[model samples]
Target: MQSPPLIIGTRGSPLALYQANLVQRLICEVSGRTEQEVIIKVLQTTGDQIKGELKYFGGKGLFTRELELALLDGRIDVAVHSMKDVPTVGHEDLVIRAILPRADVRDAFISVKYDSIDALPEGALIGSASLRRRAQLSVLRPDLTFCLLRGNVGTRLRKLEDGVCDATMLACAGLRRLEQENRITQAVEVDMMLPAPAQGAIGVEVKRDREDLTEILAPLNDRATEWAITAERAFLRALDGNCRTPIAALATLDGDVLTLRGEILAKDGSLRVAQTVSGQVSKTLDAYDLGFKMGEAVRDEVGGRITFDD
Candidate 1:
């Protein structure tokens, strides 16, 4: 009898490689499989295919499409992805079977003259790859200049030190995962800047029918992150958010309560609508209901103020 070979698909980036190995390591521990049992198969996605320009290629899914294809084609039995980059909506044939322990949920501010987004000089330039961060930055400091920057975490940080733009925004979780927490000048709170749909979460995507794999990964699941991302993704799906839209959300689970905060900004950076909701964590459907309500509320609050469409 021979053991089954597990092919793990992942994006071919430093962080992607790091995360893929972490997933494989954890799975092997839980399933009693040796390192040789799992093989990491790297894929280049649209996100990686683009350099120097992210807005032109696409948004979040740039790194996911290729690995997802590998999964669908059965070339890989599992896929590892940063939950925030994964998207709010799941696929018909695929599902996030587990969420590994989440990392920090803050945005690192890297700069020489400032410790945070606020300390930056008025009209100073800042770079970021997320529409959510750009839109929120607009609402936060209308005076500062926001530019589109695309690259891996290291590349972005290097640009900041090299003075490519002044300062840039990146997820604190990623920084922490790479043992670069000290680089963060500030870890902006969600109240001030709503995080992306699933920031800080690491998810393992497997074929929906793979119950054995699901059970194998179950021990590593972080219930709080899983639940929080579930609520946040539902919100994004309800709002129909995509490349063109500037939307952000974050949810927190404490005991039986789940707290959600969602925001939507106008395309031109003039108006903003934000909402907050809290409910029993078990009522997952309420998360969707609240997300929809928040979007509708923001739409009404802004009152034709936002027109960005994807």
Candidate 2:
């Protein structure tokens, strides 16, 4: 008798579907499973249903909660997610089984007229839903105005064409995955705007008890990307970060040395605290410790001024 197919749960968005299908193809290649033996199951998430800013609702978890619940209930064997969207704190029963190779860890500046953020006219309107982007941009161009802009990649591009806002920002990884790299006016430098934690990586989550699935997915795990994101996410978890807080972190590995950069900004961009730390990290735990220490240092500097929406 044949065994049941492996079900992969994901959100119902163009980019989400693209990530899921990519995983499906990779799984088939690695495990030598026929395409028919692997399935993609699309599920609606709160992040998709809400037409307003995520901070007003529940923050990043809105995108993964439904899929996670499905995983807990045995409705899916695994779930694929954008690592940036996955909350640092997750259900104890679930674990990220694998991380695909990372992509360009940069934010893309998109506009119909302006060539880049610096080219925008004074008092120009910038549309984005990310507190990190808005806060960072506010510091760079205090004359610019910001308004809430929320949607998938296509929706936001259409809004830009419709003249809803002068400019917007998106993840370079998402645009590349969706074949919309041409839409990027400028791939913003990390020095100007550090990316959110775990940006540009794909994470696969599975039940902790699924040793079989873990082994099956092990071939897809990218060790360097795993170590980088492990540190970044640990920084986020240390600060209890969420959509409400403007937090950014990026980790890079050089041989056995790991360097992590982190930032915490006020909502209005009036104040910012940033820090960098480096250490020899032979394992993921070492990376986590390095990040956690950086986060604590930044948090302590910011003091009680850092507040969350909840």
Candidate 3:
């Protein structure tokens, strides 16, 4: 009997399609399946419909729920997601079965006129939809202002050229995937701006009961990326963050050691709290308890003045 085709679901954006296609290529390579064996399904998401700021329409899960529903309904065998957009908590019946190797975790500075963030004159306006980016940029250039710029990679770049703001910020990974890296003015250093938790990773989700499919996709799982994402997401989970929340975390693994850094900034970027933790890798690394502890430590230091929703 012939093996059944594997249907992969993803949002219809160019970057999303690129990620899904990457998974398709990898799956075919690993399973020795033909391109015809893996099918890509383009699904619409609530996040894609909202015309204004994302915070208004429920942020974190909006981009992922439709594709997830497709998985739950058995309409697709696997769902590929930008891990950063996935909620910190899991769906009842679905689990992340694999993660592609990580890409650059740094934010990229993009502009048509200005060459870099620092080169922009004081009081320059920056365009972005992420509270995390806004808060972090505020720390570096408080004099700068921000306006909302929502949509896919192509849309944002067009808006930038049309003068939506003096410049904009985007993830380097997204640009690279979209083959728009040439448009980046500079790749912001990590110390200058720590990335959102799991910023540059892609996660593959499947129904919890699909052990067969899980095994087939297992080879694509990068152990280092998995360890780092587990830790970083733990930090987000502990902080109870959504996209509206100004929270950032990044984790790195070197040999048997894992190091994680997390940050929470007030929406206006006036107040911030940051923390870091390092540990030897073990079975417990997968548990991500260290990241949870780190998040709690920062939360305690910041107190109740934060308005995570706005």
Candidate 4:
């Protein structure tokens, strides 16, 4: 029997389309399906509709729920997502079947007038929608002020060029995927600015009922990146992090060892709680355990210090 064409769901942004096309090519290669056998479904999400600050609108799942609904209704066979946009909570019936290899897991500082973060003058205006970035950058340069800049990679850069702010921050991975890496003035080091959990990863989500598709995507999974994200996300899940909270985590693997570092900061960047945990992970589950423990420790250390109200 001939299998039906595979429909891939994704946001309509340039970066989203690029990611979807990449996944489409990979799926076709693995499943021996021709280009015509695959379809790309561009779906508009709430996040795309909101021109105001994301925090004011529905935050978590803002960019994902519509596509997820499409998946639930079988409108699409699979959904391709930027893992960072995905909420920390898991969907009961959906599973991330594959995660592409990690990208440059660092923030890119883009400024037309300044060469780098250090070059920016005090009191200069900066733009970002990520609370994590604002908190970390505020701590580094308390004199700077911020304006809300929210959009896809191209839009943000265009705004920067039009003098939206003195500078802006973006993920290096997004620029690379969009073929706009040349716009990055400086790739901020992880030490200077810790990235969000699973920041640079691309996750392929599928309804659990689709076993055949799962099998096809299994070969695309990068075990190392998967475990690394597992650790990072486990830390996020343990903290119950949301857009309101400023939380950041990163995990790195070397041989059989996994190390996770997590941070929770006050909105104003006044107080920060950070912790690091490392363990020998002969199995992937070990990374999850390590991250959970680290998260718990950080939470305990900052008890009642700052709370992100629901």
Per-residue CA lDDT of model 3 for 44-114, tens digit only, reads 99999999887778787999999999999999999999999999887889999998999999999999999
Model 2: residue 248 alpha-carbon error in angstroms: 0.8
Judged by TM-score relative to the true structure, which candidate is superior, 2 or 3? 2
The residue ranges of model 1 lying beyond 4 angstroms of the native Cα positions read 52-55, 283-286, 296-303
Question: What is candidate 3's local distance difference test score?
Answer: 0.91
**Model 2: pairs clashing at backbone N, Cα or C within 3 Å:** none
- Indicate the TM-score of model 2: 0.98
Best-fitting candidate, measured by TM-score? Answer: 2
Query: What's the CA error at residue 134 for candidate 2, in Å?
Result: 0.3
TM-scores of all predicted structures: 0.93, 0.98, 0.97, 0.97
Lowest lDDT block of 10, candidate 4: 51-60
Q: Which digits, one per residue and each the tens of the lDDT, describe model 4 over residues 1-310?
A: 9877899999999999999999999998998898889989999999999988676776769999999999999999999999988987868999998999999999999999999888999899999988889999989988889999988888888899999899999999999988889999999999999999999999999999888887799989999999999999889888888888899999999999898989999988998888888899977789889988888888889999986764
How does each model score on lDDT? 0.80, 0.93, 0.91, 0.91
- What are the C-alpha RMSDs, in order, of all predicted structures? 2.0, 1.0, 1.2, 1.2
- Model 2 misplaced regions, further than 4 Å: none
Question: Residue 298 error for model 4, in Å?
Answer: 0.6
Name the candidate that leads on lDDT: 2
Tell me how candidate 2 scores on lDDT.
0.93
Q: Give the per-residue lDDT of model 1 (tens digit) for 1-310.
A: 9877898999877888889999999988988888899989888888886765454566677778878888888899999999877866667899888888778877777776687887888999988777778778888888888777878888888777788898888888888878888888888987788787788888999988877787788897887777787888877877777777787888887898888888877755687777888887565566667666666766667675677754
Q: After TM-score superposition, what is the CA distance of residue 309 in candidate 2 from its true location, in Å?
A: 3.7
